[model samples]
Target: MATRCCIAGGGPAGLVLGYLLARSGVPVVVLEKHDDFLRDFRGDTIHPSTLQVLEDVGLLDRFLRLPHQEIGELTADVFGEVVVMADFRHLPAPRPFLVLVPQWDFLDFIADEARKFPHFELRMGARVTRVLEEDGRVAGVEVSQRGDTQEIRAGLVVAADGRHTTVRTSAGLPTTDYGAPIDVLWFHLPRTPEDPSRTGGTMRPGSMLVTLNRDTYWQCAYVIPKGSLEALRARGLPAFRRSVAEISGFLGDVVDRIASWDDVKLLSVQVSRMPRWWRDGLLCIGDAAHAMSPIGGVGINLAIQDAVAAANLLAAPLREGRLLPAHLEAVQRRREWPTRVTQRMQIALQDALLSPLLARTDVPAGVPLPVRLLQRLPLLRRLPARAIGMGVRPERVRLPPAG
Candidate 1:
């Protein structure tokens, strides 16, 4: 009999897993709660590492054709002094930069690709409320569609849910919260000539602008305190616009372009890691397993990497027999080291950007002059590209061969 895998939460991770598994001839089902792909303000940036994985999976061409933007460099402004942190042009790949595509479109595209495989099934509006266990092994999931509940029996259950993962909690796994004190206030602004290049723009001082198109708009994020969204909304449109203008000097024109309160959206940020990503016959991937702060801009990329790693490792064992704890253990071990390093880096970056004074104060005044000089060198721009390009290598991670 063929292996039956049920994937919970049809986000990028779940959808990609379904696509790869179905292509390898496994029967796969993806359940998503949302009735349609209409979410806004999701992470739209796809790092170079993720792009490489998409190319390997044969979806790069399609991904490129979607309405999107390319990011070339990341810049920082410290007390009115400009510094270039990472430049994508220096990376070795043909396409070294990050791509900014709306998450809804990307998810829809992946779902469409998964549909081409006869073994793949995507059921939107189907929400998995609980995992089904038989004899201490994950047998499947109990899901609800509209008002009706049904049971899906499968050999393996993969959870690709986001930070507040229901599956992770259901399995009784412990999650460690490494909270960052900042949150993100997201909003859209109309395109302006003063904005960075439409295709490969760099973030301007005091604001991060992701240009969507020459004529359409750009997405921006402003760092704020956690739980500040409601207070910000209560401040009303004028105050909100003023706050934006204060943070981003260039926002004078863009604030006027906003025209209405409906254009802005806010997201509270938090970073967390699951102590145990797997239990019994089930496996957790993506933000469900390791939630990272958005400061490093690697959340989506990491999630995609997790999907690739999990599929590569578990596909074969799942094909031959029931999914085992050993297989899940291997997945966690392969991902934990990279995940921890990246999370720590994220905290450091957050400190530098959001609390520069605190970061600077922490450094010794008597630090070596040569080290400070090296930090100011312009050649350091390649660092971001190098970091973004480093994703999980299937060979190193010990993934299974293609089915």
Candidate 2:
């Protein structure tokens, strides 16, 4: 099969790019290795930047109709005290709040919309094994599906296949690992009507737990030092359950739902980015290009922004067959700064806050001074709100839809 663009990975970046390209009359196919988008613990927070893109594409109203919870502000419980972190209500956008919906629902919505255009195709369970190259340019992909492998040539190939991306590695792209001091163990617990409505987490000396309110349940991420899962397991599940209950006392005995280690999913957090994101007919976006820390839950939004920028810069060129190496470089040039800025913030937070917190052995009596200042000066909260909500250099949809 042949098309204008073949995108590896059907996550936020690839699907959104495919949808936009197809809208612009570019034949595009998105290959997802998974049969379904039901994987647990994916980033689900849709920020204001992404919401603005949806509005520009005229899909905001339809997207709002989906079942999702909105968060106006981000708050965290530090040493048994609630600290207001980011206030999203004042963000400059049509939807000035963060939307929390299951990632599968969001992807399905994009896939459904893209199907309206004749040029769009989505192949689920299609795993990309290698890049097809010719004359020193990436030509297409060798994809495996249902016990058969075949070549699908394209004008361009996109490696949106995430951090452990086979496509990017196959093409021999080099990545710079900034390194993370922590990993997260994720699990779910029952949420009740009396449970806190605001989405946030709890932090204590030597331990931290992030709790995202998923309407029916709380999706919890328990942060631990890197390479320490074995030590934690040796301490036993009952001991782990006690630690969780102690930090977020409101959960009470509900923590018992974590029946065994199997109930907890390990997320080995990695923060790294490729010095160069593309070469010839290939480009890498989202986690494939830069793997982010789960600090502000901004990974999904960043990936979506990359897609919007890529589509904006490359759609017309690909449709007219005037694409060049310079066009691909423009995408990296447009997005690389934001990726670097965001990763810097995440790494600083990891080193200055998380690393020290996890290493401490004493219980603190009060919230940190920074938390107190933010709580005291309500106006200061918007700084963080703007950073998390708007991001740096948010992209707008500029490609006019082709009839």
- In model 1, residue pairs whose N, Cα or C atoms come closer than 3 Å (at least 3 residues apart or on different chains), thus clashing, are 312-400
Candidate 2 per-residue lDDT, tens place, 329-380, comes to 9999999999999999999999999999999888777888888999999999
| Residue 84 lDDT (model 1) | 53
Candidate 2: 10-residue stretch with minimal lDDT: 361-370
Error of 1 at 1 (Å): 14
What's the TM-score of each model vs. the native? Answer: 0.86, 0.99
- Candidate 1 runs further than 4 Å off: 1-3, 198-215, 230-236, 256-263, 357-376, 391-403
Most accurate candidate by TM-score: 2
Model 1: weakest 10-residue lDDT segment is 392-401
User: Which residue runs does candidate 2 get wrong by more than 4 Å?
Assistant: none
